[model samples]
Target: MQEVPVQRQHVGGSVCLLRLLGGDGHRTVRGFLGGSLLMNCKYWHGDEMKPTFWCKLGTDSDCAADIVITSKNQSMVWRERFSIRDNHAGKLFMVTTEGLAEGDMGTYLCKVQRSTTQREESYGVKVMVSTNTSAAMR
Candidate 1:
């Protein structure tokens, strides 16, 4: 059975409060080892442009340590396996990974960096990778 996406918000104990918005904010996304995974995140903060980052959930709660790819305007990380696209009119960002592998299996967070604030407002997505997709279907 397919998993259902959830929506929720999280507040840090400290001054910074991060809210998860859009997509499967509470469900884990499943994919085959060799397949690709796609994620979409949205944020709106006036006309000023902000940078969007995708990171893996590491041993520590710090998201910065697991940095993967970042996108801003028409520029972003230039990597063969990673790509990002933006829906300019809708303020939606799409992150796609090619040749998914065991190492890629993990929880990921997407956030837009607002220059006005020091804290990062993000959306969390869990990813589960399987080596045998055919067997799992049975």
Candidate 2:
């Protein structure tokens, strides 16, 4: 089986959706990531290890963040939590290329965990954050 290939990555702030192509039975994923914090990928139940996705505070503040991710549906799973240390100054998601506006401000988390298998992986919902700018209020 050679239809699918291994995903190669080592760059920071890189986003990818890794998929296993040629393998039988249960599979797992392993790798090291460091920049501001430790990030791990999680999936849904019945599914096994695959790939972990991480989002960090980029191009702003101290290059650090208090970013956290978790599943939106898993009310019982707590191991799917993620964190980004050394959070920078200023408003959150302010310096990021993909960020919020004056009326866009709130909380965001990515919930992911695998079922049956040990590895956790899957996509999550990013909470939309908006702001409000007014002259009289200022």
Candidate 3:
């Protein structure tokens, strides 16, 4: 992975926008069946007070159907097998998915909702789950 500098700009009074200069906002992750996967998403400093969302990619590639969403004032949110924790000081959030299965293999989106004036920033993640048949056979 290449290292990119974090750019911060004031969109308006008290609102900041963070952008990564030379990187595509997509990632591919592999996990074993019945295990867990963790994804880290970074955002702007001012976005700490904003809401964060984690959702399976909808048919139209939108986050219309969210699996879990964090409150603006809360640091953590959980729903069923999905959980999201926001680290304000670090300007990043972590999403954990438990009980991985074949059905969990798909694209997920992590989004940080900005002020109404600015569009939300989203990161696309592709999850691939596989089973270790050899280990199961043994």
Candidate 4:
């Protein structure tokens, strides 16, 4: 969850919604996302951990989503194991099984909804399970 500079609006109407509030859009993934281009929406159950995203919020399938993976590496903690709540299978948002180890890196969040009162986009990720440990942590 990085590359945030949004200013949403959807209030004062019968449940209009879109928000990200302040700058909670975290970031800590691999790095170099300066141009924005990462999205999978779904299809990584080979173990679970091909997490990559920068933006892919308009393919039209109704596009409803919810995903969260977190970590800031504070001695390691198992936060946000998995997510997929209001997903209409917009391709895929997240999955779990055994990918993204290293105590599961940190800093990740994806939230998009067409309901839930109002929210259209959200992302802030930072998971690095690649130290060349033979490779395989998504």
Number of the predicted model whose lDDT against the real structure is largest: 3
What TM-score does candidate 2 get on C-alpha atoms? 0.20
**What Cα-based lDDT does every candidate model obtain?**
0.58, 0.26, 0.69, 0.31
Clashes of 3: 0
Tens digits of lDDT, candidate 1, 1-138:
122342222222111112234543444566566666666666664522666777777778657453554545464464677766555566756677767778877778876776675666677776667776643122
Name the regions of candidate 1 deviating beyond 4 angstroms: 1-20, 23-25, 45-48, 64-77, 116-118, 134-138
Which portions of model 3 show Cα errors greater than 4 Å? 1-22, 133-138
In the range 1-138, model 3's lDDT, one tens digit per residue, is: 232333222222111122222145666666657666777778876888888888888688786588888987788988888899988887878788877789988888878888899988787777777685233212
Residue 76 displacement (Å), model 4:
24
TM-score of 3: 0.77
Q: Which ten residues in a row have the lowest lDDT in candidate 2?
A: 86-95
Candidates by lDDT, descending order: 3, 1, 4, 2
TM-score of each: 0.69, 0.20, 0.77, 0.25
Whichever of 3 and 4 has more lDDT, that candidate is 3
Candidate 4 — worst ten consecutive residues by lDDT sum? 13-22
**What is candidate 4's lDDT per residue for 1-138, written digit by digit as tens?**
224322222222111111222245454333111111122232222312223222212345321232343222221113243423222233334323123345445444454333456454545444445544222111
What lDDT tens digits, residue by residue, belong to model 2 across residues 1-138? 322323444354322222333233322222222111112223333332222223332344221333433233322222223332211121011111122232222222222334555543322222222222121011
Clashes of each: 0, 25, 0, 16
RMSD of each: 10.4, 17.0, 11.1, 17.2
Q: What residue runs in model 4 are displaced by over 4 Å at the alpha carbon?
A: 1-22, 29-97, 101-109, 132-138
